[model samples]
Target: MSTTAPIRLGTRRSALAQAQSGHVAEALSAIAGRPVELVPIVSEGDTNRASLSEIGGTGIFANLLREALVAGKCDILVHSLKDLPTAMPPELVIAATPARVDARDVVITRDGTPLHELRTGSAIGTGAPRRIAQVRRRAPHAKVVDIRGNVDSRLARVESGDLDAVILAAAGLSRLGSESTLHREELGLAEWPTAPGQGALAVETTVDAPAELLAALAELEDEDTRLAITVERAILAGLDVGCQAPMAAHAVVSGDSVRVRAVVYEPNGEGRIGLDVTESLNRGYIRRNGSGNEANAADGADPMRTARDIGDSAAHRLLEQGAADFLPRE
Candidate 1:
């Protein structure tokens, strides 16, 4: 708990993960007046050759890091918010969410061709179910190849002519300083909503973390970013779908209002359902609890409460419109 001691930040060993964690470490060091060191941890997702769905989806990348945190191997864990499961360990808390970057996905092609312009049968590489569904819907002529690897390896496929293009998150490329060098076409969120919490980072620690560390982390929190991701994730949680579900939800906060858009797609991308809704926050309302339930808001006007309500409402509408029919059944 000493202010001079180095804060250990646990992170996945991937280049992208390290880059993101390093940024957070630098910020924390400046705020806490202490050294912040990276603690690289290898996760199952990194070692497994199988597809994400086959190996438990995105959560595979986070479980080991959470374990290390709980076992005291690291004082904190930095996670790509999208990779976290809806349910977290009871002992842990996501203490801070730095301001988010671009939440849009991008198509990187060998010749810089936009996705819609790709020739028939052109191979497009990506392993995420949401992207697979999106690509099939957006460019029916192109072939969707299930592929998995780090960003460099995926991009290398396009560079080596093994694949015509690959879909990747814009944020990952920006964080790794590879965006400018690539021939990418950004996918707008209006038509291609990304996974919940995409482009955001989650800094987590034990509920019992030292007061000094918690205070330092609070300095990193971005209220608007947290509220937006919270709404998006609430939709995911309300749907009760696994991380591999072909679903996308995005939320944006503007002034006193927040708008959320969500979609559900069939595995083949043939059938889909979507909803868009917005709500205004009462400036005078206050958050009363951490649990996202309605009871957490004193008068049902709290911003966080409004976020959860709107998200839950959107999910309920989707279900009513038979969104469940298009999702994978457990």
Candidate 2:
């Protein structure tokens, strides 16, 4: 038997998952000074793509990997932060959140066509309820179809002449070096606020893991990203919503501050709520102490509690502003 021990890194079988896991594994290898082998785990999300709503939520993607970690099948699990549920199982913990990539949404079209230039009646494909609601609000004429699959499959649908365009996360395309497929004009944050934690990679481990491992993994934590996502996830949890709702939020770290924006939509383009909230970290309670939890008398007890407070506050304002009852009966 060989003397060296390999750390097993569990991930889904999709190209995006493999690419993401490979990147994380490389970092872990360099940090640990040892070999880390990626073990592809075919998840329920991969096998059951009939409908996300019909199954569970996007949490399906993280479930199996978390299971693998708990079962001693793997030492670590890497996930797209957006796909992970706000509340983790008691036994698992999000050990680290590395530096984030592009966190905006991008539109991909055939022949590199722009959204406005597409045929008036052309069909646009997307799987996200948030994207559909936002796209419909912007382009009321286009026929929106629900297209689900891995990134490659979704992009392939456009190339197969079945879709005029599709919306995807800019981070994924950047990671895969597939920017050639994007339409430059629609890549702005004003046009599309990304899903919470869209471009971030999260590392998860069993709660009972050795402190040495946790501490080692925690070295990769990006405080700016953790704070940004904390606010984003807070917005989501505040809304009492999951991936099923038409919700989008994004935050940017600007010199000891974070500017967060959130939006909610009705499916038929009737009602919407949006806000640009800024917190100056250097001037706030977080400046003295690293946690924003200190600034939450108005928001609630915790950071997420405050986020929920802000989300509800925004939702109520939107409702008052005549946000229509376009929420679908799913």
Candidate 3:
């Protein structure tokens, strides 16, 4: 706690990465009463403009930063939770994820048009397999094209007539301050559930991090956000799927129950295995504190176990209903 050196937070040099890390730095600084400097690290993913599937690596945005962390080049690493692989290395962990923003995807189109109003056969650009499947399912006539770039660059395609529309994370656009100025439509979550942890940030550190730093970071953890994403990712892990595959999972916490919905799509986007399941967190969380209430709520439950159960059960339900048939082959 007495270290005079500011904590170096490693991040990709992209504008979005800088912005997200900058936000985390401010929060951590306040919590630790110490300075947090954002250290820009160029990730291989940032360097490669090819499609993610073409690149063929997991945690494209995060692995490079992780290398830096392990090498003592940075004290902290921030990642888009969705870009993080479902499995964490034994030496590493996500220490915190601030409260989540909108977890839904949005479409930005030329002429300020929404998805339903777009013309037939229009080229809609997106690099994500999950988005491609949903787009094809909801708008059968539109064409899905692979695209690679930052938020602004992708948005520019629509302006320059290279594409009639583009799909992006509403959370990213909002963080970059471009959500309101552009014409966009937020997709319905029921039909277009997003990636496991889309819209959430992952704050990673080594398992043996300084106790002071770990405690400070924990102050920023949002239990609700963590549990929701954990459930989504657990379902993914239970199904043994990769990010490049066509899959989407969404979780919502309502009262005492957590409702989780997941879908695994055929590569062609012509079919899918969709299922929804709910799990009660009451037993796992409430009994920990003798006089449990809102102030004591966060630590009151073992949400991680509950989330795993929900995810595993949901994936099992889908498998029972033939989810495996639609999954992409290894």
| Local lDDT at 58 for model 3 | 69
What's the residue-level lDDT of 38 in candidate 3? 89
lDDT of 3 by residue, 112-204 (tens): 777866789999998888888778887788888999998988888888889998999988987887643457888888878999988999899
Q: Encode model 2's per-residue lDDT on 130-191: one tens digit a residue.
A: 88787787677788888779777877877887888888887887777764543544467765
Superposition TM-score, candidate 1 onto the true structure: 0.94
How much lDDT does each candidate structure score?
0.89, 0.75, 0.84
Ranking by TM-score: 1, 3, 2
User: Can you write out model 1's per-residue Cα lDDT over 103-199, one digit (the tens) per residue?
Assistant: 9999998778899899999999988888889999999999999999999999888988899999999999989987535588999999999999999
Candidate 2: where is the Cα deviation over 4 Å? 1-4, 53-56, 179-185, 282-330
Off by over 4 Å in 3: 179-181, 283-301
Model 2 collision count: 3
Q: Can you give the lDDT of residue 99 in candidate 1?
A: 100
TM-score of each: 0.94, 0.85, 0.92
> Model 1, which residues run further than 4 Å from truth?
179-181, 284-301
What overall lDDT, based on C-alpha atoms, would model 1 receive against the true structure? 0.89
lDDT of 3: 0.84
Clashes (backbone N, CA, C under 3 Å), per candidate, total 0, 3, 1
